[model samples]
Target: MQIYDVCIIGAGPVGLSLAAALQKSKQLNKVLILDSIKKPKFNKQGLPNQRVLSVTQSSREVLQSVGAWDKLEQGRVNPYNRMIIDESNGQDYLEFKNQQAHIIEYDNIVNALLEVYDGEIEFESKLEKIELKPNEYVTVNDKFQCKLLIGSDGNKSKVKECSNIGTYGHSYHQMGIVCTVERTDQDSEVAYQTYLSNGCPLALLPLYNPYSSIVWTAYMDDYKYLMSLSDEEFLKVLNSQLGRYAPRIKSISNKRMAFPLQSLQAQRYIQKRIALIGDAAHSNHPMAGQGMNMGINDAALLANCIIKNSRSGNDIGLEQSLEEYESQAKLMNYTTSIAMELIKNTYENKTISPLRQLGAKIINNLDPIKQIMIQYGSKHPLGPSQFEWVK
Candidate 1:
């Protein structure tokens, strides 16, 4: 059996990004990536997919370092230089006057990373089992052996379960519904989000000309009613609810999708030779738009940790050596998740609505507080530094 240096399960953006980042490591050799899903296929002239991500500037730097940012540019990339957050009562508001984030389709991101990645990737390889020996290595299906194993398989991580890692989190009563529509006005450059009286926050994310992606977070009953509406009826309600913000929904570009919201975190990120990253380690509420960013940051930190361990001539798979990666990532992710939960609870709970309004008002007037948030959301403090990649 050829024991590889590292084996990563799942070929999603997180996994692919890790692979690309590790390719720059001088000491690492022989990486194996496995995933059941085949590579995505996108026509040159198709509309952007409904599953889009709010990519932070920090994330763009990571992709740029790996020679993937230019790939995204070939597709539809909408740069929203500002964000306008307002409440239902229209009393308090917050705005950020910087190119903080961009809206990119999930498929475009995955495809871009896949283009610059160079490694042994085995597609249609569903992970059935993982066995990790305390002082030895990890075996996948008794065939592929690796000194270190990584799980980027998302919320239902097979590697996490096989390693006996426990997770704890409760499901929010809300469901997230997403779709893309064309607005009457195509000149808006800012991302707009409004908190409704019923606690549902509707977001209009800028896309290409006259189009914006909508993410409406609401209770299941509301979700069901919206889902049940006909095309025209849905447009009527959406236009009415968003009023002038959305103008009129000329048409629904794609099929709508919904999923339950929850915050799940694994008890431990590392066990012997195996470590979990991305959604496998933690899942957060979409209200913050930090789920993908956190996962990408995890990959970067873990890669740096591996590089440092290699330089010290230490076992990269040793749980002790990998402790720093886990500690830093868990701390950052936990803090962000908790903050997002508090925000969700504050507005979602009717009793605390006034308090939320008051807090927003206070935050609006406080420039320092607003700057802190913009700094955190726009770029991560400890992310990988900007680098010029050889194109």
Candidate 2:
């Protein structure tokens, strides 16, 4: 049987990134990554994928540490420096004029991470079984063994299931309709988000010139209705709802896709020799676009803990070392999850409309407060100041 120092399940951005980070440690070798699907392929000439991520500055640093940030195609990466926030009533609006985030396609991120990762990857290798032996390596699928098992799969993670980890979260009873749309205007450097009267938040995120991606969070019934509409009809409704806050939508440039929204957190980030990261560990609302950011932070933190333990000649899979990772990651994830929920509820509650409007006005006028908000939104508070392996 083959034995590895670490076995990571799921080869998405998070898993691939963790592999890249681990490779920085000279003492750690024999790392393996397994994914059930084929490796992701990026097409430069094809239309952008509907799924996208708002990569924050903190996440950019993590990618930079692994040498993956430079591998991203510059033309495809869109950076938005200005953000416009408003509501359907137009009673108030908040505008921020600082560097916020970058919009990148999901495939682009995975491809970049895969390129920089120097480790073994098993594509189409689904994990069937996991056996945990006390103070010993974990057996995967009865074929491979590893001292530490990391789950970066996703919300419906098989590793979490086999490890008997439970998750707690509630569905938002909403779906996010995502698509690429062509805009008539040329203001592609600004990102726009509007809270509609119906209690859904619609975001128009900039992409390459004349193209922007839209994430419209709608109630279940509204999502169904929107999906049922023809392209033209859907564009009409979208433009009407956006009003003057966003650019005029010319047409739908890509196929529309919808994903259910929910906030999920694993009861515990680690169990014996196993640890979870990414969506497997926690997930939050997309309103703040921090889901992937949090996951990347998780991978970075875990890599730090593992490397520190290995250098000290301590067992990397021991609960004591793993708890260091869990404490920091769980605190960040839980706090972000609660903040997102509060934002969602605050905007949706009709009785608090007046107060919400007043608060928006107040926030807009207070430059100091707005600056603080922008800094927090653009960076993760718990992210490492400097990666130990980067030096």
Candidate 3:
């Protein structure tokens, strides 16, 4: 048995982040990474279709710690200075503004994070097996007999599965069709969104000059038609629903792709010494585009947990600590998922329900409400609700 202090499963963002975080610990070492894909095998299918991550302040700090934040070009990732969220029932909108809310291309951030990794990566190495002894010592693929294990692969994480941890959610029946489109309006650096009676609202997130990232969520059946539409027809459909909110529409280019939306949470984030982080533990709807940012935050929390507890002369893989991490993560993930889904549901009503309209008016009219959201979304601007651990 190859005994070690820790072993990481999955080489995606969460996995890589965990591995990198562990490598940074002078108190810890003997970390090994095993993933199903080949090393450097990033999901490059969305090359043309840019991904925009709405990162919070805290998450941004985590990325910088791992050197991922510095790899991005200043112009590649644009800030979300303004946001327009509308109700389905009425023409009213809840708009928010912040000088600091930023957006980064998905692949750019991932590749950047991967660039700083300078350790063992056993890619194309699937989790063919996972054995957790009663002592909480885990053996993965009959290779790792380590004291700690982390599941950061993804929603369908094999580490979570092999451990027999139960899942507690289902699919949202919505798919996010993301793409890049050229914009004509030069002054449109702000983000814009519009609610449609046609179901599933469309969001136009500003990117660098002349391009905006479109995360169009629609029903299962409607997704095909939206994707199949030719550039001209697609632009027409988008113009009709989003023209008012979108900048001057020009050519829609880039790889357009769709991903099923889901709201999932593991029944327990820890089983023995193995801990789950990022999407493996909880997967939220992307309506808010905080998925990766949340994952980054998870990385930060666990990294701190390991560092704090290990220094206290306690086993970093204690059940109590893992449970605490889970409880904290579950609350935040569930809350964000529900909020995004609720906001999505409320956007399709033709009447813009009175209460919803009031919310729009309240948020739009009140700077505090808008700032609160910016703080919540950016995980910054410091508020009373901000957890002490994050600061």
For model 2, how does the per-residue alpha-carbon lDDT over 150-259 read when each residue is reduced to its tens digit?
99999889999999999998888899999999998998789999999977889999999888999999999899999999999999999999846678899998778999
TM-score of each: 0.94, 0.98, 0.89
**How many clashes (backbone atoms < 3 Å, residues ≥3 apart in a chain or on different chains) does model 3 have?**
10
Q: Compute the lDDT for candidate 3.
A: 0.73
lDDT on C-alpha atoms for all candidate structures? 0.82, 0.89, 0.73
Candidate 2 lDDT for residue 203: 95
Rank by lDDT (best first):
2, 1, 3
lDDT of 1 by residue, 93-170 (tens): 766677568898888898888888878998888999977777888889888899999999999999999999999897
Report how far off residue 83 is in candidate 2 (Å): 0.8
Model 3 over residues 1-391: C-alpha lDDT tens digits?
8777777887777777666666666557677778887655345334333566766677666666666678655556676677877634476777677647676776666677677777777778888788878466787888668888888888998888988999988887888888889887875558876666665668888776777878888888888999888888898887767835557678888767888888888888886788898888888877677787677667766776776677777787778656666666766777777777677676655465777777777777788867777777777222112222233
Instruction: TM-score winner between 2 and 3, please give it.
Output: 2
Worst 10 residues of 3 by lDDT: 380-389
Query: Candidate 1 at 207: error in angstroms?
Result: 0.8
